[model samples]
Structures are given as C-alpha cells and as structure tokens.
Target chain A: MNEVSKPIPVADAETAPYWDGCREGRLLIQQCADCRRRRFPPHRLCPHCHSANADWVEATGRGKVYSWIVVNHPVPKEVYREEVPYVVALIELEEGVRMVSNIVGCDPHDVAADMPVSVFFEPADGGMVLPRFRPATGAA
Target chain B: MYGLRDKYAIAGVGETAYTRNSGVPVLDLAVEACLNAARDAGVDVKDVDGIVSYNFGDSAPAIAVATALGIPNVGYAVDFAGGGNAANLITLSAAAAMEAGLAKKVLCFRAMNGRSGFRLGGGREMLARGVTQHTAPFGWITYPQAMAMWARRHIVKYGTSAEEFGSVAVTFRENASLNERAMQRAPITMDDYLASRFIVEPFRMLDICLESDGACAVLMTDAARAKDMAKKPVYIMGGAYGGGPDQGEDLFDAIRWPDHSENYAAYIADDLWKSAGVGPRDVDVAQIYDCFTYSVLMQLEGFGFAKPGEAGAYCASGAIRRDGELPLNTHGGLLSEAYIHGFNHVVEAVRQLRGECGPRQVEGAEIALTTAGAMTCGSAMVLRN
Candidate 1:
C-alpha cells in the first residue's frame, strides 16, 4: 500500500466537539435537550423538534451495519488507490442514529447488513484521529 | 387548485450533439441550444424574453445566454444553484413565470462540458465539504460510493440482485441503439452488463451514467400561444420539487434519512399524480433519471409504478422496453444517451409526446413522465400532448 496520507476530517463550529470526542477516543453524539432525540454529524438545531439547545453525550459505540459499499474505484488516487475494495458503511447506532465509518477487522466481502459493530479510534493525517467500526465482540 | 396543469406548454425542444468534447465555450453551447429551440418553435429569437438554467457553478448564467441570444428585453431570468434535480424545476419555474405574467417565451436550458471540463466523477477538492467531512476520511469521497451504499441497503431490504440492476442497463442500451443522438448506441446484452467492471460494489461501470458534454433547451409559453408554434405543444401537466422529512439542506444526508431504500420520489409521488390528474397506469412512456441503474429502480418504486421491493423484478421482466407496458428511457436516458444534467430526459419526453422519435417513438404516446435526481432532493413532471 502507498504511504501517502489520507484526507483528514475538517471540523467546523458545529462539529468541533464531535472531533474533540474522537480525539479523546470517545464516540460523542448530540442529544436535544427538549425532545431528547439524538443526532449525528453535530448540527445547530434538532431536526425533530427544532430546538437549538443540545448537549454532547458519550455513545455506547455499538451499532449495526445498516448499509455498505466496497469501493473499487478510488478518487484522489494518491490517498486511496492502494485502499481499493475497502468497505465503507453506514452504521446505525443502538441509540437510533446513523453515521458513516469504515468497516475494519473483517473482509470487505464478508461484511453484511445488520452485522453488529463497535467503534475504535485510529490515527489519520495531521495528528487527527478518526472513529472506525469493527465487528462487535462480547466485551463492550 | 391544479392551476398549472395544462396552463403552459413546451412548444419546442433542442439539443446539441452529445460528445465527449464540444471544443467550444459553455456559453456558445447555450446560445446554440436556445437558437435551435427558437427555430424549432418558429418563435423569433427577438421575441424570446425570459431564460432559466441550472448548474453546479459549471455553466453559463441565464443573463449571459440572454445576452448571447440578443433578447431585446429580458422579462424574467434566473439560474438555480444545483445539478440534475433542478432540471424539471427550471421548466416549472419558467412555466410559473409565464402563468404569473412575469414573462412569455421562457427558455429553460442546461449546458455543460462535463467530459472535457469539471467532470462530475473527477477528483475535485470542493466535493469534500459538508456531510462529506464525516465520510471522506474513510475513502468514501465520490458519489458512486455513497449511492452504492443506498443501493446495497435496497438489496438487503428487497433482495435486489446484480442481474436485476444489469437489466436496466441492458434495456436502456437497447433503446439507445435506436436513438441516433445517443452517445453509446452500440447494443449490449445482459451478459455485457454483468461483465462490466464494478465501480463500487452493487454498481458496475455499465450501471453508471455517461459523462458527456452537451446542452439541451426547451421553450415554454402560455397554452394559447403554443398552438401557433411550429411544432405540436407538449403541455406541462403537473410536477413537484424539494425534499421531504429527514432530508437536510445537504445532499445525500442518508444518516438522518429514516429509510435508505426510499428516495425523494416517495414523498412527492402523490402530489405529482394528484396534480397531474393521472395515475401511474396512465403514463404512456417515462424518461426516468438514470444517473445510475439503481436510481431507475428506486424511482420506479417511488413513483408507484411498482410496489416497494418489486421494481427489480419489474425491470427484469422487460416491462421498461419500448414494446413493454411502460416504455421507458426511449432516448436511452443518461445511462446510454448523454447526461445533460437530466435536461435531455425532458427533451426526449417532449419529442416522444410529439411523435418526433421516429424509430424509438412510443406509438401514440399521449402522456409521459420524467424524473430528475435520486437519493437527495429531486423533482418530477408529467407531460401531455
């Protein structure tokens, strides 16, 4: 595989805390204070109740594979050409929120829908750490 | 109530030759298409007073096209800031303008050198924005990969197979063989579709749309003035645009969208049929936006042509062929024809309604349906001759 670095996540004002949580090896999601609904990719207001008041809560990091794709054609070839056929999936957390992440620790072809997965952190470009998912084990 | 139905008509449609390299400025293509549309309608260019176009910052502005066309005075002009989803909306906006007495002879068009310049599939830095910020770090950087995830969800939920998706590609290619304007006219079978390399899991190269350089334009006016035009007018029966619940301002926000298998079509289908005063069974032909083969399947289910989880079988059963019950993509769609940002689909629908598609024509096709975009926010319209 090529040694080139991958694109790091650029955190904006709304998503800074989520990245902060990832840097600390915690999976954080926003929960609306009004309706008690949780959401991902941190936003300004609750999509459900339109409340601007929300707080970041540490998640269980346990999710199921809702959907996934094995990308064979990689763009930004320098960064991903060596990672062809990597599995990228939408993980539906136990809290009922979905987010995008990589399905590691298993064969890309073996990944299936509803497969239970748990999150782990990995170092990325520029000292940034990203949250990825792998098949869940009995522990946590 | 339903006031826009049959109130305005597309009097003429025009398209430049679909090519990988137009070798001209986008403005030139826009002007060429506008002139061709005016000529097709027998409407003097000097009398054209309004313009509408859409792009992702890759096309000429409406005012620039108007300046090129030399319209003495522009009564109304606007450009939507989007891609394929804006195709039908531009026409709808133009028709609404005419209905509101804001302008007459409004020309709606889309022009792009998609192959030679600013390719949708190419590696561009701007694509890594918004929701992509969360996914791009994991090598999920392009549209096909994101859409493939949705396609995979459909497969898991509905038992959709690769062969079934391939059937859509095969059918459109068959239709394209009869279309001289199509970019990939050489016929391909289901075997060829299966053999094509995968771009992403559940999506082969054949299943994806062509990246083409082209332009398409349609002229709209009041129904009264349409009767005097050079060609038979295709009335704008009804249409709807925008997103539904769970669809945020960002594109492909599948994380918040409740069902990955469902598309924007489901939310708007009822309104589309209700306003058109016609059911899915009444459509004689359909030009479904086929940015990807699975998109066609999703729209088929979304538009009520087939029940959810049944579009795969419906397509594989030869139901979308020209001789089938619901002739679809008669001009080969974006898959085999060319991608003019779905504007070409509108042009083909107008031609089919006018009986101008000599070889690929649906015999006596009176009513047609055309959809734009998939996954994200979308739009659709019904047309009648």
Candidate 2:
C-alpha cells in the first residue's frame, strides 16, 4: 500500500469497474440492460429507466469539448501548484454521455466548445491510470 | 399547493457585522445572531423551541445553538445539506413547524467565518461528496468553474459578450456603494470590470462573490402570531423548493450537460407566482443569489424576468438597477455584500418589504422575490409587506 500525493479517484463498488476499465485504457460506460440507454459517472440503477440491471460497455473515447473553463488563479494547494491555469472541460462523447476531465497535449487557452477531443490515459500516483483527453488531430 | 401560502411570517431579522475577520468562533457568531433575532421579535430565548439551519458542516448545528442559548428542549430541528440551496428551505421548515404547533417560536439562522477560518473556494472539495471525484483530481474543484461552463455555453448560443458579464458586476458594485454593510464599497465601472484579472475564463475577479465573516438569522411564526411582535411582519407570500431534470440519482449527469442554461428554479417559477398570487411584474425588489455574475443572468431567465437569450440585453438596458424596472440585489448580493451562503439575501428581502433599506430601497416596494443558488438544487420565496 502506498500513499498518493494527488487526489485520485476513490472507486466504490458502483464505480470500481469503470475505474478498472480506465486502467485498461478503455472508457467504460453504463448501459441499462432493459432500456439500453447509456449513462456516465457510473450508477447501480439505470438513471433513465430505473432498471436495477445494467451492463458495462466500452465507449468510443471520442467526444467534443462541450464546454470548458480555464482556471487562471492558483489554488491554495501544494499538490495543484504545477497545474495552475489548467483547463477543466466537460467532454461530451459521441454517445451523448458527458464526463469532466482535464484537457492535455494542447494549450489550455486554445480549448473551445465543439472542439474534437479523444480520451488519453495517464498514470496517476496511486498506481492507477486515469483517463484524460487530448485534442483530436486525426480522422475517427 | 398553496396551503402554506401566507401561513407564516418572518417576525424578525438579525445579523452580525460583515467583516473580513470576526476574531470569534463560529458558534459564538451563531449564538449572537440567534439572540439578536429573538430580541428583534420581542421573544425570549426560552420561547424558541424550533431551530433550523443548513446541512453544510460550516455553521453550528441547531442543537448546538439551542444548548448555547440555554434552551431546555427543542421540538423540531433540521440541518439541510445544500449551501445556498438551503437558504429559504431553513425558513420554510421553521414556518411549517410553527404552523403545525410543533414549536411556537422558530429560529432560522446561518453563521460563517469564511474569510477568517475557511474559504469555500480556497480548496479542492465540493460541498457534497461523490460529485467531484472525477473533477477535483484535475483542479476543477470550485463552483465558479461549473458556472464558467454554463456562461460560455450561453455566450456561444446567444452571442453574449463579456461586456454583459461586466455589467452585472458593475450593477452590484454600484448598489454596494449605497450599502454600509457591503464588503466592497469602492464602486466599479464596466471598464474596471473588464480590466479585472480572470479567475476562471469567462468569469473575472469581480464576477465572483466576496468571502466575509458574518451571520444572519430570522424568526418565523404563524401570520396571526406575527401581529403581536415588535416589528411589522413580513409575510411569506409564497415559496417553493425543488430540483430539475437529471439531478436526482447519480447527480453527476446534468439535464443538458454542458448547457445548464435551464435551472431547477425555472420549474417552479409559475408555481411561486401562483402561490403568491402575483407575477414577475409585481415584484418590487429581488435578491437573487449571485455566486457568479453569470449565474445572475441565468436566474433572470429561469425566473421569467427575461427570455432565454435576452437577459444580457435586459440587464444592459439598466432594467436591474436600483431605480430600474426590477431593483435586483439591492444589498449588492454576494458579489458586493457579505456571503453568509444565501441567508443575507433573505434578510434583504424582508428589509425591502418593510421599507427599511433606506438609500437602496425600492420605492413602494410591496412585494419582494429572493432566489437561492441556481442551476443546481435550489429554492425561492416571495415576500410581501
């Protein structure tokens, strides 16, 4: 057991599989087995249909920058100092599911709405891989 | 739906001086506010059997306040969890308890030492758990970030300009100059607002609310019992608390994800007016919760003061000024006034209805509307003199 200096995702029973999928370089989304609608941030019962039964499915990992905010102030935290003035964006996947992640591999100021992006995994401090996004440069 | 309409009235409102440093404990602030509220209502501390506050862990609990006040017992007490979302709910709970004979004199209050002790925006945590695990790891930990997202989407859709956002901060600062208790009273121009540094893109330094050390408390009782109180009663004409689409279960997925132009308050806009038996035009003053300037724009749309993409123009035309069609946030709101969550707005609503806000008062103000935090879980109330 090791301590992680940065805040990492503490996966509970409901979200463990999704985090596990991220570690495997796959973006896992929840699809209701009955209603067959997709959801993000993981849930037990289907948010759309209230069906207790659901399945983990891999997503295309491609989304558009639905909206974003470039934080210019330095948060009063030692761990977040290096990441000052970072862009935190709501990336909406092609499946119509949205997730919050940081935009990397591009200038934070260059981020814009409807800009194409793709999921990219980074090794976090907790020996786990966290899913992030980079600007989509090539064709789907 | 309107059964509780006018059933309760705010008998008294009290608050500690807004300051950057209180040099006291949060519990002390809470007790001071409660005692002042009880005195304002001409009620003894012993008569307050119902105590209610927000569920946020910042303030002293209801039982803590009662114990410190030397009350023997409490018939009803609840601490709701949402921040500004719980402002009006605290009073609504007190009113309901008093009307049901659960308690005679109910005390609702909020106290915080945000500047001296802990700043709500100075760290990497959300008020509630689970919602920010995905975001906080990436420094997306503050409310302004979410609000920035909402603002950018609105701008892209409606062709809103940064000048529109500056107008909101400028209006609040202008009103704050008239409020002696306001934290920022230097006054600002649209040029000053434009030149301010950006905290979160689309939101400048002036777009955010001030973090001050203060407290606000109000006493609630039945309308019939309010006539016997010392001050003139401010009746609770109507109130509603509710949530909108996709906010229920997971809480992570929003109704329209990045586009949060629609809010929970809009769902109950008609219901609130119908309950109060008035329309938006009847509101003489408004104290809208303004965590960010853009949020005020969203709320104007949600509460039907302006059409979806028209709030920017509406505000730009000076319609929300102190002498405008709607004298909004006359106490300067959180942008310039102290932020005790949204409780300060409620106190201002009561003052406007009673015609106690001297320089910033809305002329012939018979009705007032105060809205809690918007976009997420929220609440609103209509008050009448």
In model 2, what are the clashing residue pairs, if there are any?
B55-B80
lDDT of 2: 0.83
Residue A140 local lDDT, model 1 = 38
CA lDDT, every model vs. true structure: 0.89, 0.83
Worst 10 residues of 2 chain B by lDDT: B249-258
lDDT tens readout by residue for model 2, B1-385? 3678887999998999999999999989999998998898898988888999984578789899999999887999888776787788788778777767789889999999988987887765422236556666666766676678778788878888888878888998999999999999998998899999998898889988999899999988888889999999999988878766667333233424434766666777877778888888888899998888887888889889999988888888899999899988999999999898999999999988888889988889998999987666678899998
Error of 2 at B340 (Å): 0.7
Which prediction has the highest lDDT against the true structure?
1
**lDDT per residue as tens, model 1, B1-385:** 1678899999988879999999999998999998899899999988998999998889999999999888888999999998778889898899888878889899999999999998887654522456777877788767787689888889999999988999899999999999999999999988899899988998899989999998999999999999999999999899988656767545645677778797888888988898899999999999998999999999999999999999999999999999999999999999999989899999999999989899898999999999998886788999999
Candidate 1 TM-score, true structure as reference? 0.97
